[model samples]
Target: DQQVKQNSPSLSVQEGRISILNCDYTNSMFDYFLWYKKYPAEGPTFLISISSIKDKNEDGRFTVFLNKSAKHLSLHIVPSQPGDSAVYFCAARPGSQGNLIFGKGTKLSVKP
Candidate 1:
């Protein structure tokens, strides 16, 4: 079973537009949600995160929203730039250990 799923394999956006990525999970044990931004040939870097206790978290141009009842989450990047073009991965960890379960990934291409 796919514990985590990223429906879109890729997305394209204009430099100043908003880019939205979606993710869903089936495991109820998950209590923490994280978003990672990855560039070519590099490990994913933590972007933003939300806990099951809260519904939303935001940083600079990035925001993450979680819906516990629906077992769903999303990431939004505003005024996306070329520098933001990369693969975004959604990860979740259960209440105990901090090890993460990851989605396939969504590649975002921001045109200048």
Candidate 2:
């Protein structure tokens, strides 16, 4: 079974609205979670991250929330803009390894 999963294959939002993405994990060993935004032909770039120790971490309009007990996490982007349209990936790293397990990204379309 995949350790990480993004149930929604895609999401759409109007510019200046909020975009919410969800993710789930099966591995309890994961300690660090991260979100990445990817553009076509380009590699995924880091967006936001949160540790299992914290329930929430925010960076400006991007925020990551982790629910350790439920093995779930989510990313929220406020004021979504057309430029923000891209694939959003959810990743997790086990406490002992540097390798990250990534979910099949959720494509986000921010319509103008």
| Local accuracy of candidate 1 as per-residue lDDT tens digits, 1-112 | 8899999999999999999999999999999999999999999999999989999998999999998889999999998999999999999997767689999999999999
Q: Which residue runs of candidate 2 sit more than 4 Å off their true CA positions?
A: none
- Per-prediction TM-score to the true structure, in the order listed: 0.96, 0.96
Q: All candidates: CA RMSD in angstroms? A: 0.9, 0.8
Which ten-residue region of model 1 has the weakest summed lDDT?
Answer: 91-100
Full-model lDDT for every candidate: 0.94, 0.94
TM-score of 1: 0.96
Q: Give the TM-score comparing model 2 with the true structure, all chains together.
A: 0.96
In terms of lDDT, the poorest run of 10 residues in model 2 is: 92-101
Clash count for each candidate, listed in order shown: 0, 0
Give the per-residue lDDT digits (tens) of candidate 2, residues 1-112: 8999999999999999999999999999998999999999999999998988999999999988899899999999998989999999999998856699999999999999
